[model samples]
Structures are given as C-alpha cells and as structure tokens.
Target: MYYIHLEGVPMQCVLVWLWHIVRSLTSIEKILLRDRPQTLYDLSSKGTVPVLQLADGSVIDESVDIMKWALKRNDPEHWYKENFDHQDGLVNKNDEIFKKRLDRYKYHVRFPERSYQDHRADVSEILNEYNSLLEPGPYMFGKDICFTDIALMPFVRQCAHVDLEWFNSSFPELGAWLDRLKESELFISIMVKYPIWNESESGQYVTWE
Candidate 1:
C-alpha cells in the first residue's frame, strides 16, 4: 500500500486497512508516497496514494475499488451483503460532493472565491443530510456497520476534526458515529506509526493476520 500521511489519518489507506483486518489478510508493504520510488509511477502513471499491487501483478489504485476487491474475496462481517444501491449512493456522494466541500473548507484560503464561513456552510449542509439519516440510532443502514459506514467514516472524521466543538454541538449523532469507529481496536491497530519508506532500504511490512 502506498499512501501519504496527512494529519495522521491517511484517509484511503485506513479504508483498506479496515478491510484487511476483517479479512485476516497478511503481508502488506506500507510505502509513503513522498518517498515512493520511480517504480511506483512506472506501475501506475496516475501516481495516486493507496495503490495496491496484488501478488498476481495486478494493481488497484482507486480507494473504493480496492475496498470492493478485498470484500469480494472475504467479507466475514457481511459488509457488502446488504444495501448495495444505498451504499453506493452514499459513498458516491461522500467521494464526489462531500469531499470537494471538505477540501474547500479545510483549505479555504486556496479558494479565494468563497469565505471560510461559506465553505464551512457548504459542508454543514451535507453533514446535516447525513445526520438526518442516522435518525433513530447507530450506523448508516441500521445498527450494524455496513459498507457505507466504513466508506464515509474517514472523510467525516476529517470534517469533524476541522472544528470538533462545532461538530459535536451541531451534529451529535454524526459525531458519536465517528467517535465509535475512531475508538475501535481495528482503527487503533492500523494507526501505529511506521518509519517513512525509502527506496534505498527495505520498507516496513504490516502483517495483518
């Protein structure tokens, strides 16, 4: 897995780590994008983070695509068994719309057209929509955590951290949902800091099984 560590989250990398934990997979090499060798670009010209090269020499670059590939092999918790359309719908909204607003809000100075408050208001609208979805209790679909929950959790966490006080006050349900996932054993395990991978030396391999 090749990923860039940003604010200690490394968004998409953590998504793949969640699947790896549930599937009991083993032997993944963690490479920092900043220290990635030219071989990585040779493998995929797109040069994105969280790139996974399988034993079969096939590559999976997109984050959600990597999640689907892993789950297809083993999904003991049945994360993909139910809510197919609903899951896809929410994940798409998160990746496409919510992420854009989040980036703008996070780096509002880069987007001079909109004030920081305007960018935050745009994100708040989407957060409110997701908050309403958690109407009665936990998780996106129901009590059980499904594909949608895992897919959107990291991004929501990023937004919440921007202003945690406001997030908790404005959307308690969403804040709670983020906290539950953040405090999980699985989340904690993946968060162990590894030395930055270097081309001149052997990189760190995280054994998941």
Candidate 2:
C-alpha cells in the first residue's frame, strides 16, 4: 500500500504482503497472491489497497481490518498480540505520536521551508518522554519488553536511514532499541524484502515471532 501510494503503481494484490509468512491462510491473502482486488464487493468506489472480500461476500477496505482477517486465522508466534500491547500498551503511544512525528520529520521535504529538524525535535521530545519513563533495561518501562518496542521500531529504522550517524549520536537508547529490532531475524526477514508496494522500491509490512 505504501509502495502503491508513494510510487503510484496500479497495486494489484498481496504479491507483497510486506510481512513474511510461509503460507497464506485467509482466502483474501491467497487471492491477493494471484491477483489484486479491483472491485471488492462492489466497493471499488471506496478506494484502498486491501479491499478484502469475505466468505459471506462482504468487503473490508481498511488495512488493519485486512491484517486482522489474514492473521487471526494464523498467528503461531503471537506477533500480533505482542505488537498490540494488551497491557498498558505503551506501543500505542509510540505508534500514535512517535510515529507521526517521525513521519513528518522523515518527509519534511514535503512540508518545505521547515527542515526535518523541526519535525525531528517533536519526535525527540516524545522519545525523551519515553526515556524519562524508561529505566535502562532498554525497554520502555523498567524491565518489560512490551509491544512498544515492536510497534515503534520501524519508524526508528527509517529515522536511522535519514541520518544514521546523526541519529545514532543523538539517541543512544533509541539506537539500541533499533539495533535489537534489526538484529532480530523476524524484522530483517519481513522488512528487507517485498515488492516495495509499487512505491519507493520498498514494502510496508513487518512480522515477528
């Protein structure tokens, strides 16, 4: 979806799920493998990448809905639950605010006049809030490696790319979090490859164990 929006490819289906899976479980995933949906339940007028057609012929156009349908049927490693942050769910915080700041900062060029630094300052302030709540074990909280770690790592990855040397120098703890995610086979495998979603020659999915 990101690829399609970014590069403007006439997105077909899930030829690139972004996240890795050995096999397709939901019929939607499988159908996407063969071809992308053009008119999901006659909802093409709505417009979206994963307009999923259900067993009852109902269609869902949201990304989260599509993922829920596909993964609910097959989540052996519990990545979804872990990523969701059922307890306290600080990951939701990171996803909601941190990622938004990171997005603005990473794409500051679109905003013009304002530099990436302007947006990055907001991201930095949020990270500092996380840091304030942190206790050095490297997780958001004192010792629990919660969903916050998993949910927020991708934007951190993109931040690193924006300026690895600068990013590493500024936020050591955040860098460490990024390092942990990068070292994990789940993140690397799921993130490193994909059809780039027809956008920036990169995909927009992440999977984990």
90-185: candidate 1 lDDT, tens digit per residue: 899888999999999998999999899999999999999889988777988888887788888888988998999999999989998899888877
The 0-to-1 C-alpha lDDT of every candidate, in the order given, reads 0.74, 0.51
Clashing pairs in 1: none
Task: Count clashes in each candidate, considering only residues at least 3 apart in sequence or on different chains.
Answer: 0, 5
Regions of candidate 2 where Cα sits further than 4 Å from its true position: 1-89, 113-115, 132-134, 141-145, 195-209
| 10 residues in a row with least lDDT, candidate 1 | 1-10
Per-residue lDDT of 181-202 in model 2, one digit per residue for the tens? 5676655443322242332223
Best candidate, lDDT-wise?
1
In model 2, how large is the Cα lDDT of residue 21?
Answer: 36
lDDT for predicted candidate 2 compared with the true structure? 0.51
